[model samples]
Target: MGAVRETLDAVRLVDHHCHGTVAADLGRDAFESLLTEGEAWPGISPFDSPAGVAVRRHCAPLLDLPRHTPAEEYLARRSELGRREVQRRFLRAAGTDVFCVDTGYAPDPLTTPREIAEAAGGTSYEVVRLEGVAESVQTAGVEPDAYADTFRTAALEAVRRPGVVAVKSVAAYRTGFDLDPARPSEVEVTEAARRWFARGGRLDDPVLVRHLLWTAVDLGLPLQLHTGFGDSDIRLHRADPARLTDWLHLTAGTIPVLLLHCWPYQRQAAYLAAVFERVYLDVGLTLHHVGPARAGGVLAEALEITPFRKLLYSSDAYGVAEFFHLGALAFRQGLAELLQGRVDADELSLPDALRIARWTGRDNALRVYRLEADGPEDD
Candidate 1:
């Protein structure tokens, strides 16, 4: 008990993946207001029907509306939204000191890179991480198969960036389910990705995902994959994390692949994490769907069997600052207490408690991202 308490106390964690920068740009007040009004941010799909719209209005304030204006208005708000003041305020709720900003769609060249670096340095945390995916397929109308070379080139370049710390692919079903891990062979998937690129689809295809995995392994880099259940249209059957066995087998001992929030399928995800040697996971969307109570239970169950060291903290924070702030705070408190069990209250040690927190909080990301090592420091 003392050691667990001490472990949780010494924890120094980082949110491996977050869209805090986008929330910062929204200005706290604006974000709060919009959230109250029921607008959806980019991470979760937008509402389409009148009923959905009504639901968002009721649920908006509960969301961390990290932004106020439309995508077109981002540039003018950069200066104020990019500052450390908002970041510090946000971190006060969650005990993290660093976060990685995913700048996949910054319109302004200067703003995009600058935001990444600056956000890291902001009060809530430091280190702005950059990432790049094969935009050639979607933007160029090329076949998914044709984009392999282009993806490779882009990934190589992204890896070279000074602040980039990881590589990722947005190929899986973002709706409510996970992709069938048993689906096509890696080669088949890669070819499909190439064709998707050729067709001018804006999303990464299977080919790019295969190439990204191989490249990450070769470079000793960590890769984040959009797994589990997300979006509304995703097939629940395909969303099971169990199907990732083959994929995990392929990357075993080579490079780490993080499964992001399989939610309803978290048990499945946890089971896979327990079996895989190099797999890691995060509960990104659970903040919204599972609530703090259930989230605590789910996470505790996962940590009890799988190595606690393999878990990482993340909200997949996007659209609003409050969402990131509160979600993170809830995770910290929930996870901390969950790990404590029925220990003597007077025996609690902040350092031990923090250390436990770090295992799932920041240490996992550091190890997976290989951030402490001296190298290119990018993907």
Candidate 2:
């Protein structure tokens, strides 16, 4: 117990897939909204939920409050500290060594990758969102005949930026994983672009989406796919990573394909990771949402058949700074309990448990993202 817990406590994490925190101070309603994947409604508060309770139990202490502090009290204390102070306390307390931030989804002003690192005390790398790049190409206006080449060029250039480590797709939100596994031909792309340009809003055209995904393979960077359990926009059944079996097979041997957040479908995700050489997964969003108490259950399901090296840690912590602390706390507590129990039962040894802790929390991310060559940024 002492060995594994101590090892994980000291391990510095690489948040392989996350989004920026809000730069502005938030009121109760606004802060609560970020705590949930669902919208706020009358008679319901995110404070009553698992994620909210976790914030009070776990994050309260970081803000100089006791565990299980009441929601109103918690927010009042946060207000007294100022948003920047609150953000600094939580981010620094998270002890994350590197942040691979998805710099795309910004409905509100968010800290940039550099700003996040500056606040959190570590290096920050960018994860380009393929959908954002495609939409940018749309905004820049490309001829339908040239749309395929134009988007490909834009995506290519986006990943080539300094400190850019990976690319992400919200295909789960935009279309779903049930699309045809084959890459859309140039003619199909041009035709889709013609319809898309005429409609001119969000890029949900299945053909164009396929083009974007295939282009990610061509870009030669690890690809992160949003799979399972997001907001109302996701058709849950279609977001299952198993639905991506055909696509994964087609893109085999290209680059690492990371499945993010997988909650209800974690077993399905585990199956994919066990079978596919390049497939990897993290139950990031699930941790803070389930809270530390239930994190072990979610992690157990995710590790049922997932190869030891295939699992990674992430927060998927967007909008709120408390998630940064809660996510890491849950990971440490849940993983420590699970691995320590295995060692107690003689199913695992202490040394092996410690190694697994390091791999999942930090080393695997550096290996997958190829960030090892950069050495320690603090050095």
Candidate 3:
């Protein structure tokens, strides 16, 4: 236990994928709403969920309260501290040195990348969401035949922007992983865009989604694909990362493909990471929701067959600073316990356990994302 504590406590995490904290103080209802990914039940509160309970136990202390503070009292205390101080407490407590932020989801009312860096006292970089860029082009009214060229230009420009470290896709939410391995033809993309434009709705066209993905691939930046358990938008069965085998084979050495939030299919994700040199996985959003007690089990399963270097840390935290703290807390506790157990049992040496801890917690992300060793220092 002493050795485990030493290794994990010394780790300064790199949150490879996450989102910004809410810019304002949240009321009880608002705070509870961020606790679960599921839609709210009319009669029940979100605070009754696993994530909410975990927050009361783990996060209450960071807010200067005793562990297991009552939710009502917790909320009252949070309100009293106000948003900025609360953000400061939780983000600093997480002890992350760098944040690679996905700035696409629910963009409004959240801290910008610069703001997140300022609040968290860490370096920050941007992950350009392919779908958001596509939607912006569509909303800007690109001509049908010009859509492909227009999108290409937009994607290239996005990746070239300062502080942009990677590109991401919510393809699991838009279309499942069962996409054709080949890039869509120019004609196919134009027609898909035309029809989507004619329908005048969100960009759910599979062809356009495919085009967007391949475009990101062509740019040669690490590409993040959301997989497994997500919001109501995800079809659990269809979100399996295994379905991506065909596409993974197609894009084999082009760029690193990161599978995010893999829960129910973590073993499958592990298999992919083992077989493909360019594939990697993270159990981020899943960890904080499961809380510290169960986080070790999930982390154990994810690491069971995964190459140590192919695993990375992430909070997947959005709209709330507690998630940032909770995700990091769960990861450190869970991983330390598992690795130390192996050392105690003589399955791994103390030195090897400490080295593996640093690889997963920070070094792996830096290598995959091409980030500097120290990242952009906080100004």
By lDDT, the best candidate is 2
- Models 1 onward score TM values of 0.68, 0.97, 0.97
Q: What tens digits encode model 3's per-residue C-alpha lDDT throughout 1-379?
A: 5687677878889999999877788987788878999888888987787898889999999888999899999999999999899988998899888899998887447888777787777789999999999889999988999999998899999888888999999999988877887899999998999899999877788898889888988999999999999989888888999999988888899999999999989999999999998999999999999998999999999999999999999999998999999999999999999999999999999999999999999999998998974555321
> What are the lDDT scores of the predictions, listed in order?
0.54, 0.91, 0.90
True lDDT of residue 243, candidate 2: 93
Positional deviation of 144 in candidate 2, in angstroms? Answer: 0.5
lDDT, candidate 1, 48-136, per-residue tens: 33322422332232234333333223323433445354444444445445565565644322223234334434322222221245553
Q: Record all residue pairs in model 2 with backbone atoms less than 3 Å apart, i.e. clashing.
A: none
Q: Could you give candidate 2's per-residue lDDT for residues 221-269 as a string of tens digits?
A: 9999999999998999889999999989999999899999998999999
Clashing pairs in 3: none
